[model samples]
Target chain A: MTYCVGMMLEKGLVFMSDTRTNAGLDNISTFQKMKIWEQPGQGVITLMSAGNLATTQAVVSILDERTKAHDERDPSILAVPSMFQAARLIAKTLKDVIANHAQVGQRADSAFNATLILGGQIAGGPPRLFLIYPEGNFIEAGADTPFFQIGEMMYGRPILVRAYEPGLSFEEAMRLLLVSFDSTIKANLTVGLPLDFHFYETDSLEQGKTGRISADDPYFLAISQGWGEALKSALDQQPTFEF
Target chain B: MTYCVGMMLEKGLVFMSDTRTNAGLDNISTFQKMKIWEQPGQGVITLMSAGNLATTQAVVSILDERTKAHDERDPSILAVPSMFQAARLIAKTLKDVIANHAQVGQRADSAFNATLILGGQIAGGPPRLFLIYPEGNFIEAGADTPFFQIGEMMYGRPILVRAYEPGLSFEEAMRLLLVSFDSTIKANLTVGLPLDFHFYETDSLEQGKTGRISADDPYFLAISQGWGEALKSALDQQPTFEF
Candidate 1:
């Protein structure tokens, strides 16, 4: 299980993904699920995935190889003309990876399915975010739906729906994401720190600030504890039922 | 889909369930998922169910008929020796309903599966809570886990984990539950108003208080709107991230 979210805000795009991966309840490990591909001053692409680890890793490795080997047969994500094209390329890679795995062992196709959130900007296009399905189709986030979440999303979604504002600054956005992640991590064992995040300043066409939040990060700890007390206080303020 | 929660508190027990039932996104209707049997001063039993509506309604009907007809073959839930026996009786009835359906028409057994939360007190026994599964087995909630939620639980669970207290007054407990339900209703279409609630006071050996909170109920409306504002204010109080 995993939890990844990408928000398209006025300042830019913010992405966060948990590292924990598990094959079963008893078998778990930490694996990076966020990948950033950037050609400074050209294009920057960020992909966060949640699903079968092997399928996601294979898709990422294939995308990385294409970028590094300068292979004309397969264009790099950084070479895509628009964020839409990059999403299409990633969706195709994800579907192909799942298909190849299914054929090898003749396993259920669902076993190798993966979902991804892709957000980025190319030199000539505006910043965009998409939720790519395992079937090679995708949907973009726009004004009405300004964010995308993949993997173990329910526990953290209500807060995002209520607190997210289009004009929030990067700092406020990160604070929101951490609060969202904190709610998820506390409720499910499958998602945890250290969380990885990247910020893409709108129309920059370059890599933006990025950081990893370890388990003991003071800010994360404060948010986790503070949110609980805050929620309690919030509840206290509501009118109690008279029965 | 549904959302039903039963919390065991120091004062006694509190139960809440949403009334929305859906065959698909387009086919939805209001169906009460809560049943109460109270032999005032003898015993009081409350059952909240989530899952296949047909299976749950069948179980409730069967239980109801047995109590009404005074059938020798089927005992009334009110006649159970203890809260544990009541849970066992409910679990077995649930399992039989699913099995009977599966044998008649070769559909997946999971299609008929239903989960239930049973909480109450008998004249000689203390108030207790059980989470009954479709497999004819159930587990009781204790100090470590004081509540049970079935169906569409994730969206509403974090607040319960953070706000529930054993010493809470019935009013405060109901307040906590409304917040939990409001979060779920906003995040999911499958769970909605009107909400049903029941309270059993410890050692009362009888039904406590029960009510229905319709969508337009002023208190329900206040909590729903007030909670969002409180949450935003809480978020504002948190220190912002520095990048």
Candidate 2:
């Protein structure tokens, strides 16, 4: 399983993903899920994927090849003028990739296909976040739905639903994200440590902050420690029942 | 779907379960999952189940008959001197119920099995908690593992993992339990409001502090509000970087 989250906040976009991939309990491996496309000051976009690791990697490779092969004239995430167009392009690319693979071999089902979080900005457009479905169509994040998550998501969604706000500080948002991810990691062995992510700032628009985060990373450790303490104390203050 | 938990603490034991039962998303109904069989000074045993209502109901009904029949001749949870024996009896009963039903026109893979949390104290014995399996086998909660959860449990486990202690005050434990349940409710529509439960103090050997909880309950509202604010603040404090 995997965990990828996209937070479309008032300031900008926050996207994160865990690197762990496991075929079984003993066959765990690290695979970076966050993919980025950049054109310096013109455009910047990130794709964080989950499900059917091979399919995600295939779609990403095709997109990357399109961007590199000028004569191929294939539409690409960085070349798209608007976020909507970029999302549509991604969906089409995914659909095409799955179709191409299915024609030669396996079909898309529970074991195959992919889901992705596409969030970024082109020079003239506002930052947007989209949850691209397996069928390829996507929904943009709305104010009421400020964030989107895919794969192993339920474990972390309560925190996002209960607390997320557009004006949250970058650090504050990171803290919430870490705690959410922590809860997921603790409950699920498939969604492990060493997160992969990129945080794209609003007009500063480059590929953004990127890293391979570990369990012992200072920020993650702080959120985990602070949250555990908060929960303990919060429970301590509630009224007791009379037997 | 359900959210049932049992905790064995130094002070005593706490058991809680929601009453919601659903045949499908649109066809949800209420059915109490908690059951108590007390012989006052002799024993106090409680079981909270999560899974197929039919199978669990059948198992509990038979267990009820055993106690009423003065089943000293056959082992029963209420008649067992040791909590471990009680767990074994509960498991064996569940397995028997499932097996019998499966043989008579029931679906082969019935999804009819249920998991249970059985907790209480029997006079001279210490408070005990067991996570009863769908197969009728169960494991006792240890000092390091003081609690167990069944059914739609991942969403709510964060608080319990963070707040639980061997000797937490009853109020603290209950509050933590509610917070955990609230998280479960927010994430899964199957496990719902109007919970049914009670706490059993060690030697009290009776159903103590029993109640039916709803979404509008005051204590719950307070926890949700406080938790939301705390989470937002915590999220806001995390660090973000400029691309």
Give the whole-model CA lDDT for all candidates, comma-separated.
0.92, 0.82
Error of 2 at A3 (Å): 1.5
Q: What digit string (tens of lDDT, one per residue) describes model 1 on residues B48-124?
A: 99999999999999888878885454577778899998988889899999999989967784999999999999988
- Candidate 2: stretches off by over 4 Å: A99-109, A237-243, B69-77, B106-110, B233-243
Worst 10 residues of 2 chain A by lDDT: A234-243
TM-score of candidate 2 chain A against the true chain A: 0.94
Best by TM-score: 1
Which lDDT value does model 2 have at A230?
Answer: 63
**Model 1 regions lying over 4 Å from their true place:** A71-74, B71-74
DockQ of 1: 0.90
RMSD of each: 1.1, 2.7
Model 1 docking category? high
